[model samples]
Every structure is written in C-alpha cells, then in structure tokens.
Target: MACIDTLLAAFAEVAVDPDAQLEKHLAAGKRVVGVGPYHVPEELVHAAGAVPFGVWGCVGSSVEAKKYFPPFYCSLCQMTLEMGLTGTLDKLSGMMITGLCDTLRAFSQNWKAGMGSKVPMIYVTNAQNRFIEAGRRYTVEAYAEVKRRVEECCDALVTDEALARSIKLYNEWRATMREFVALAGQHPAEVSVSARSSVINAGYYMDKAEHMSMVQELNAALAAAPVSLSGYKPIVLSGIYEDIPAITAILEENGFAIVADDMAKESRAFSRQVPETGDPLEALADGWCALRADTELFDPRKEHIEQVVELAKDNAAAGVVILLAKFCDPEEFEAPLVKKALGKAGIPAVTIEVDQSTESYEQARTQLETFADLLG
Candidate 1:
C-alpha cells in the first residue's frame, strides 16, 4: 500500500505539473524534449540520451491560443500551443510537432512562428498510407529528418546500436506496462480508475527505465495482494485524454473499474513496441505503421472499432465508456461508430461529453451512476 501511495502521488504530481517533472529531470543534467500528440519517435529522443516528455495540452481554456486556432479546435492543441507561447515548455531542449490532424497541422505552423525561437522545433509526420513500400520509405525519410533535428539539438549521432538499445529498453517498458495494466484489473477494488491511469501516464513524463522498475515493484505488490470483489464492474475507456481527474473517483464510487482503454493518451501510444531486429529507424517507422484505429491519425479503415470490441470481450467488461473530448471532431466522428460497434457486439456503453477545463462533472456523475445501474 505504501508503494502504491507513493507511486500514485508521484504520478498525480507529474500529471498536473509536467514542467516541474521535466525541470527536475533537467536539473539531473538530462536533456528533455517535448512532443505533441499521436506518434513520436521517442526512441530517437532516447537514443540521443534525452527524455521524451509528452506535451499533450493542459486542462484549461487557452485564451491566447485563439489567435492560431478557432474555438472549436482541440484543447489538446490549444493548451499545448498556449504552453509554447507562454514559455511553460521553454525548459525543453527542443520540441517535436506532428501533422496528424488539421488542428496539429495549423499548430505546427503556429508553434514554429511563435515558439520556435524559444525552443527549437522539429516537424515530424508518420506516413498515412503506411502499408505500402513507398509509404515505408516516406516514413523512413521523415524519421531521418526527425533524427537529424534531434541530433542537431543534442549535438550527437543516434547510432544504430544506440537506437537498438533504446528500442530494447522501450520494449521492456511496454511489456512491463502491459503487465501492469493486466495486474491493475485483478486489484481494482484497491486501485481506483485514476490510480490506474496515473501509473500509466507517469511513463510519458518520467524516464521509461526508471518508470519500468517502479511499475515492476507495483505490479508485484498488486499481484501478491490481489483484491476480489463480486460486484466490481470492469469497463473499457475509449477516447483521447481521460484526464478528467474527478471522474475517476466518481466512477469508482459508482462501481466501475477500467480494465482496458483505446485512448490516444494511454494504451494506444505505447502498445506497439519498436522492433529490435530491423534497421533502427526503419523499425521505429514501422512501429508507427502498427499504430491502428487511433482517432487522431488518418485511418480510413477504422480498425479501432474492432479493437474496442475485442478489448471489451477480452476484459469481460460490462460496458464501454466513451470519454469523448467535446469539439474533437475525430473523436466525435469515432463516438457513433464505437457505439454502433459495441451495440452490435451486444456490449453496453455510455458516452459522456467532456472538455479540458471542466469545472463540474455533475452530469458525468449522473451518467456514470445511471450506467453502473444498467450494468447490474
């Protein structure tokens, strides 16, 4: 329990104040790089001996970000750009921006124009048509640009051996995380939804190697002290950021345990480990190719719906929860499809509208209570 509490406290701190965590890392003489949404070459950053801190936007209305994006734009983009403009992310040695979505495409331009001087910027793109040889080549070239920018910023060459080592370390981290998520399910009575999310989210802000060690300890403790509850309900959370902190407590109070999620911010990011056998950069690019059905990326095939159904079945979940970020078009587009898929699979699901700066979750609470009641 002490180990659990300490890890949770650390995760909560970093989730709320990512810059503080990054600054602490910097003070340790390690360079940290900021990366925006969807896919990033974290292995490349790691290979260069730098930290790859996820720069998913904050929890607030970004008033200044309006100059670049409309009100309907994603808060993830809004708050991320606000951080760059406000210099909240100035401590980063550099930042990597990707053009996965329209908002991010505009954000890349805005960030370069506004925050590029403050923090050197790297433009990255994962090939959308990623199954073809041409797409693979394109992705490799794109990653080469990312590697070059990363090298320029750190003044180091990311050797094949270094990249291979990073890939191995990251794969170990991914394996540990998978084990952690599975273990979290067995002890849901003790592990709140937020606690589970935090343990996973901590990986983005902290060193993977260090996070993996602690996760291993936490998983061992959890496995040794498993909690059994006949009435505890398991569910899969599918969407982008499920970071509405209060919702977790409310869900636990209402008897929900998140066993699996297809969130862009959570499992989807690290589910595919970079292969250690291939040419390192090519392997990293190939990992990006493996990222499927993520709402943020361009996937006309929409395999995410199938993935969600499988997740629910595999977890024995009573239902699926759609924590849809309000005004996020991609997620909004996905919501109905997910609902339809779950419905067809005979799975119950509830969709709750959410935003970054939610002052109240009274509606969410009622919805959750109603969903939990239906699960019975």
Candidate 2:
C-alpha cells in the first residue's frame, strides 16, 4: 500500500476554497442559511427564495469552536459554533437549527443570542423515528413552525406552489447526486474520488437547479472520461463522520474506492418533501416521511446494518471502514455491533477514530493504509 505521507501531501493540493465558494453566492444578492446533519427539507428554504447551506463544520478548525460550547459537544456542533462566534457566518441571512441532538438544541439558543441580528435562527425537530406517532406529529408541527419562522424572518408569504416547485427542484438535484453515486459504484476513477464527493457537497451552496446542472455537466464529462482500471477492491465507508474529500483521498490513494457509504452527512440523506397542497405544512410533513422512508425505517440499528450490508454486497465492497469521531458516544456504543455483523458477513472492517481537534492527518492516512492491508 502507498505510504500515508505521500497521501497527505497530495490531499493538501486538492483543496476546495469553501470560504470563497460561500462568498460567490453571497455577493450575488443571495442569502445563505445553515442547516445541521439531520435531514432538512431544503425545499422550504429554496421556496422562500433563500439558499440553504448544510454546515458540516471545518475538519481542521474545531479548536476555535471549543470557546463557545463545551469540548464535550461533538465536533460537528463545535465547528459550527466557532464559525458563528467568529462571525464567519456573517454572510448568512439566517440559520436553521435542527433539534437532532441536545448539543444542536443548545446551539440554536446560543446562536440566536450571539448572532441573531446578523443571522436569524429557526429551530426544527426531525421526523426520524417512524414507530412513534408522537414523533410524526411533532415533525409535522416542527415543519409548520419552520415554515412560519422562515416566512416571518424573510417577510414573505410562502405559497404552496412555490414550495412544490422548490421540491421539484431539490428532487432533481437528488437524482443528479444519485447519478454520480451510480457512476462511482460502477466506475470509480471515471470521476476522480474528490470530484465525486465535491459534487455532492456542492448541493448545499447553490440553488437546486443550478447545482443539478453542474452535476449533469460533471456527469457527462465523467461518462466520456476513460475507464478506471479494475483489480482494486471496493470499500463501504461507515460511522458518524466523513467529509467527502477525506474519504475520497484515502480510498483513491490506497487503490480501493468508496463504492458506497453509510455516513449520515454523505450518503444516507436524499430529497424528502411534502406533497404540493394548499396546506404547505402537511405537504412538508409528507415529504419528510417519504424521504426518510427511502433511507429505510428510523431504527438506528436496523438502518446502520442494512446500509453496511447493502453497500457491501451491491458494490462488492471488500470491507467497511468506520470513520468515527473519538469521543462520539452514540457511534462508540454501536461500533462493536456493526463490527461483529461485518465479520459475520465475511467482510473485513476497521475503525479510525478521530476527534474534532485531531491534528494528525498522517495518523488517518496510516489507519487507512492498515485497512487497505487488511482487505488484501
């Protein structure tokens, strides 16, 4: 396998200027809003004539985040909090906070107190659990609340037709993303690993139609590109944390490509919407149900295993890689169960635990090389 140093040096060269990318849209008289990990019906934001950027946190910048929130908060939340405190999110016209976890719920209140004048805050509850009727009802109420919040903050009436059109636009964007996934699954190098990951991440920054168009052009270019050599095995990247480039860099360098993934930020989410009806609220709820349903039921255990097995078999992934954060309790508890299942399925797997403030990219490279060796 290739050494980790060469890989890290190469990754440094393949950077994306996220700050510059954010500036481009902001200068065009567009408002940028932030959303966290829980699945957001971005259609509502789009219909309201604002741009919804999924704030996944800066991988190397979480040290600055610890000042506002406790270090115990997940890196994802910390990075976002740091960004808000530093006024990096000053360009944002507003921000939506998902009540996905305790940290985020606290984040909503802290952010409002700190940056409410510059960026408005909307708190949303997710419809992630299916068995609980109260869960579904809470989601519906939250959707309505989000709609109301956005409408009031933006000072605009959110009509049903606008929301439905927004849904159609986002749906197309989702289809475009799937096209990339299908291509990568079948032909990894036809599109460079980082390029594929970047396209998916780009969805958060631009309008749905514009983003979809960019992917289509990228897809056409990839389709016409030369085929990647075979004999390199496949791997399914799992666990709670993976930035697109981080996963792509490890896989491509080690001669193993990520054919599929179960990472919440990358693969598990897709376009979910409520139907276009006179009641925008109900339609929003219905859309969320369908979107989550597409990912499988809300049971964490079932969903995690299903993703690992399906990706492994369908893409012929040789092993699974759990790209987890060091102090993440939820993923830490679930790791053994997932590890055992992958073992029973005859797929070799490994874990690489990284903290939000992790400074050792070299360590990540080393662990990934070990994973590649295990697969061999």
Q: TM-score of every model?
A: 0.95, 0.86
- List runs of model 1 lying over 4 Å from the truth: none
112-155 per-residue lDDT for model 1 (tens digits): 88875779888898778877788889999999999999998777
Measured by lDDT, the strongest candidate is 1
Candidate 2, superposed: residue stretches over 4 Å from native? 1-15, 221-229, 244-248, 271-280, 291-301
lDDT per residue for candidate 2 within 296-367, as digits (tens), equals 235554566655776788877888888776656567767787788888888888888766566656777898
Q: Which residue pairs clash in candidate 1?
A: none
Report the Cα lDDT for residue 309, model 2: 71
For model 1, how many clashes?
0
Considering every candidate listed, which one attains the maximal TM-score? 1
CA shift at 42, candidate 1, in angstroms? 1.0
What is candidate 2's TM-score against the reference? 0.86
